[model samples]
Target: MSLSEVTARMAKAADQAGRSMDDLSLIAVSKVQPNERVASVLDEGHRIFGENKVQEAAAKWPMFRETYENIELHLIGPLQTNKARQAMHLAQAIHTVDRLKLATTIARLAQELGSCPDLFVQVNTGEEPQKSGILPTEADEFIAEVRELDLPLVGLMCIPPVDEEPSLHFALLAKIAARNGLQGLSMGMSGDFERAIALGATHIRVGSAIFGERDYG
Candidate 1:
């Protein structure tokens, strides 16, 4: 899909949900995409983006950011304790903070660096054993813990069990955010972003559907 197609679809989704398009933010997930594809999006003037790894984003975004003014970058995948400092510098937002050690590190780095972009706590609503989010039952406690650390807590993010109804997971995430008084809901991806918007996803990440599938190698 093209950038226009994605934004048009996003607008339609927001309209259907009775929300303004201006209230929603679309993050082009450029995790594994090549620079050529990223440049294509840049050429189109889409300013927001998401990436999965700090190292990869560190390697790729400086040149892009230097070329394009006011581009907002989000780190939307698992974060490591060691990379917390780098992430605090590289991303305008961090969407996968899930544990005490990492969150602790991020809090420290945010203070030491004096730069704390928006932060989202990742919750494993599906309770998938292998996933990289905090357990659903632990979300409240986790949020409280992070708050005690004085990190810039902003919202919640979740990737549902791919087999189940995405709307269910999206709603669950919204509920969690509401319970905790968070305003941002970083749910949705290419497959179910429309549904995510209807259910209250303030931020949606789109990748392959726009950039095409990536080669892991």
Candidate 2:
């Protein structure tokens, strides 16, 4: 699908959910995509994009920033502690702040640099051991811990098990964010974003749907 189609669909979903267009952010996931495809999207006046790796973002976005104004980058994948500074410099938001160790690293870096990106706690609503998120039961305490570090904890994020229904996870994430008084819910992707918006997703990460299928080769 093209950018306009996605935007129109998102608008319809938000309108149906009683949310204003201003309340939503569309993060075009540009991971593994060619710079030509990414540039095409940029030419369409899209400023907000997402990258899955700090290395990829560091490699790709500087040239784009030289050309585009107000480009907003988001880190939507796992972040290593050592790369926290680079990720902070590259992205406006970090959606995978999953553990205390990484959180502490970010806090220390913020102290030294005197700045930090907006952060979202990633919650493993499905309790998948292989996934990089705090367990649902541990999310509240983790949020508190992040707050103690004085980090900019703007919201929560989750990626549901691919085989399972996404709305359940989205709703669970929304519930967690609500009790913690966080308004940003970074849940949803190409397939179930409408359902996610219905359950309170403030940020939708649409990858191939916006950039076309990625050629990993």
**Candidate 1, superposed: residue stretches over 4 Å from native:** none
* Per-residue accuracy of model 1 over 1-217 as CA lDDT, tens digit each: 8789999999999999999998899999998899999999999988899999999999999999889999999999898888888888888999998889988888778788887989999999999999999998989999999999988898999999989999999999999999999999999999999999999999999998888898799
Q: What lDDT does model 2 reach?
A: 0.95
**Collision pairs in model 2:** none
Q: What is the lDDT of residue 160 in candidate 2?
A: 100
Off by over 4 Å in 2: none
TM-score of each: 0.97, 0.99
For residues 1-217, could you state the per-residue lDDT of candidate 2 as single tens digits?
A: 9899999999999999998889999999999999999999999999999999999999999999999999999999999999999999888999999989999999999999899999999999999989999999999999999999999999999999999999989999999999999999999999999999999999999999998899988
